[model samples]
Target chain A: MKKTELLFLKEDVDIPYNWAAGRYGSLFLTRLRDEGKFIGNRCPSCGKVYLPPRVVCGPCFTPPEEIVELGDTGTLVSYSVVNYPFIDPETGSRRPIPYTLGYIRLDGCDTYLSHFVDETDPAKLTPGLRVKAVFRPREERTGRLQDVLHFKIVD
Target chain B: MATKVAVVGIGMTENKSRWDLSLPGLYRLAYQRALEDCGLKSEDIDAVAFGHSPEYFEGVNHPEKWCGEAVGALNKPLFRVHTGGTVGGSVAIAAYYLVASGKFEVVLAISGNKLNETSSAQIGLSTVYDPIMGRQFAAGAPSAVAVQASKYYSQYGYNEDHGLMVAVKNRNNALKNPYAQLRIPDYTLEGARNTPMLCHPLRLADMCPTSDAACAMIFAAEHRVEAITDNPAWVLSAVAVNEGINYVDRDWSKPIGLRKAAELAYERAGIKDPRRELDVVEVYDAFSVQELIWYEGLKLCDWGEGGRLMESGATRMEGDIPVNPSGGTLCANSIGASAMFRKAEAALQVMGRAGEHQIPGVRRALGHGWGGGIQFHTIMIFGKDKP
Candidate 1:
């Protein structure tokens, strides 16, 4: 007799981390949530403004002192559209398929931000295309990079 | 000593994130710079020594495996040393031993820490504490140093202002140091005083900024020194000591290990007095108060008289003896290279190669590095004339 299906037990992993985002992380997250705008940290040594502000510049090994405000519009560097189905770790459910993921360089940053894009079409989702971040409503905003819902293609 | 050794070449990369270069590339730059400094070929080096801060900071253990070739260790014996912040100093001592033991005629020592690979070095530093007790409160280095600062202030009858003065002085000095990282123009005690306190008795201004930096020094036997450079910074003596921590009778201010290291270094260097004989000095001041405390540990001043020594302008750039003329760990602290910079700066001063921050007429100079719960201490003395 042939087996119809495989048997398995499914449960959520109960690991909880009281993660400290550190000084730079805390500053970036709080500002993203409160102002609904991106702030950049500039490495004083090599003059690069990193995305997801960090304490030291990876290239120069120097601490960045300058805080720069960034525009919402950016250029999509490279991207891939999801066609395969996978479980969403956040919600414990199958994530919607055919979602576009892009690495975008914001107007004033030297580093790229990896996030979702609204455009799903491979043709429409062109490299070097201008994109703008779409943020969650003020009341619903959480202090996270997810505060910005996704990037929408711009003309 | 079986064979006399002298530092023939020194190379230092600017302390910063160094985002532009790979870890191997950074090591290569410093090694190449050192080779160029003394006109040495890769074939001239017989051995290489590598040192770096704990692997947790960069999330890469045994960086020496790949970095060894970058420092000209290919087909040569490589010695790797790691002693927390004093890794650089220890590497220098290791190279000295390699050459002095008659085993190697020419040796190159390299040390650095790329702290940016990890999100926060504090998270890596947090793991350095005693897991059973200290890990629970894991504020990392700052919390421990703050307590030390409080103890020093309480014992010496000094206040936060003393540290503020050191901060201002070092930052101002950094303006003259082309390689220094935190060159705050027109830095003043008043400005530093107003900066918000991160921990008690510790202002944000009083702390060392972390950088991804590397330092390289080439040591050669006396016979090989003339071919490398005309004026070699002769190593007079090098000493490393460690202090045991005690919960019952702990006193961070006294610094027993540093005192013992200094005493041994001075004795072996045949120096009667450090203040008068040493023309320049570099001490690992990871934090501002540590500089003052190190003054006592180095015997530049009596215990509790470090604040007074600073007040007397003895360590100022234009004082009786210049301390941290290169802006020191205060301005550019690359954890692995931080302590090594102390030795390299002193060597540069005595060699008359220290550019903008060069002190006039430096005959003898001293470098000091301390780390690992303030337990380990390394002291190196260099002289213009061979001992």
Candidate 2:
């Protein structure tokens, strides 16, 4: 038997992190850091409201007919505490792990929006937990999903 | 009697880490080749059926919109179908329906994947599993296949040598394929055995290459087939079958979707014994173990006999039933395009157009694709003479 040297090389490559922009199904989430205003898209065909509006209604296959104002209060449908740091597109760096990401079913919307949760305790999180949207400060507000700081446990 | 649909022309772009061309540029190259092969212009195409895997693979959503003009689908009836890796073959199946219905005289089926455009296709594929059940266990495609391989070996008492032999044979065959991406000059079973393991029971060489390429095929009704080419590869049967996504319920060691899809295709193609009736086979082998599993799923061999089939050299190019004469997805996998390439390669073999990898006297060829956690499966049967 002969021995062969086997080595794996990791290449550093510059890649486009924002290639999803300008696409037809591009999702737009308004930064709601300071205010509690809720936004959603309404499908004219089915009259169903979709939170974190989709370009086309999954059932109807039609573009959203109108924009609807949703309630900031919603029920937490599902959640997970990410134990590993994930690459952040905005920073091009790894974000701290153990952060709470949850699906919030806003009032009047048929679907849920995936966002960060403020409460870090995994034990405290449960399905159907009432939460309210917390917005970023007005000065730091940007027109992105991150503008909605996180979802906080509503007292 | 329903009119038969046959493949009139086929074309494919070079498979590699394509950085020289953009997404649309890739489609134009294959589309042009297909049109020229059929001796027709874009205007002659009645409709377009396109398939690409996850939109995330290209970092573009609604890729059909971007690829419309390049594939000559601009302002034409264009439909996009995605079933993960099987999407390419599914697209051809969709095109066949259009021609078989006697509504469309000619349909152009195109598929492509730009793995280079995505920062990490592995990450994209990893996200496809259930967020909770499989995501944590996901070590990407290699690890999943390795898990299946481990189970198969444990159950069947097969050794790692079988996989090494497959890698060596496929890579060797790739030398004859001009479109193959990973061409090794002195590839051998010994070289494969020494390669580092990406996951247990699965070495790096056992996995398919992440190439960026496009493949297109023109489908026409029986009335229009003779006008396009004298040697049309008639489509005998096409079938797509889906199974539950949960890997826990099904046997990962064996693919049920593939078996079901193959059974349905065999029934429609009037095939009694695939080993005797089918002359060539192009299966979806993203991993070496998958080809072995597919050998049984396709019924080329009995259950628990896939390893023996390989050991007996029954699947070689000169074997009783030639499998993967095109080097399969192992040599070049442009995910979306690979499935279409299987169908195209099988058709080419039947048409006697496959220059180097052609199996002598190939009359009936089977093409298959599987994707989405192995939940989606597509099978197509092509023959030199009309069914």
Which candidate wins on TM-score? 2
Chain B alone, TM-score of each model?
A: 0.98, 0.98
Per-residue accuracy of model 1 over B27-129 as CA lDDT, tens digit each: 8998999999999998999999899988877766799986887888888899889899889999999999999999899999899888876666776676676
Which runs of model 1 end up more than 4 angstroms from their true locations?
Answer: A1-155
Candidate 2: tens digits of C-alpha lDDT, residues B1-387: 667999998989999976667788899999999999989999999999998888767777898888899999977899898888988999999999999998899999999989877666776776675442234334446545655676576567786787777887788888888999988999988889888655546677888988999999999999888878999999999999886543222356677778888899999999999999999999988887778889999999887889899989989888998888888899999999999999999999999889898888989999998887677889999998888
Q: Rate the local accuracy (lDDT) of all candidates.
A: 0.82, 0.79
Write model 1 residue lDDT over A53-90, tens digit each, in one string.
Answer: 76777557788878888999998765555543433433
Q: What is candidate 2's DockQ? A: 0.03
Off by over 4 Å in 2: A1-155
Decoy 1 TM-score against native: 0.72
Where is the poorest 10-residue window by lDDT in model 1 chain B?
B130-139
Please state the error at residue B168 of candidate 2 in Å. Answer: 1.0
My TM-score estimates for the predictions, one after another, are 0.72, 0.73
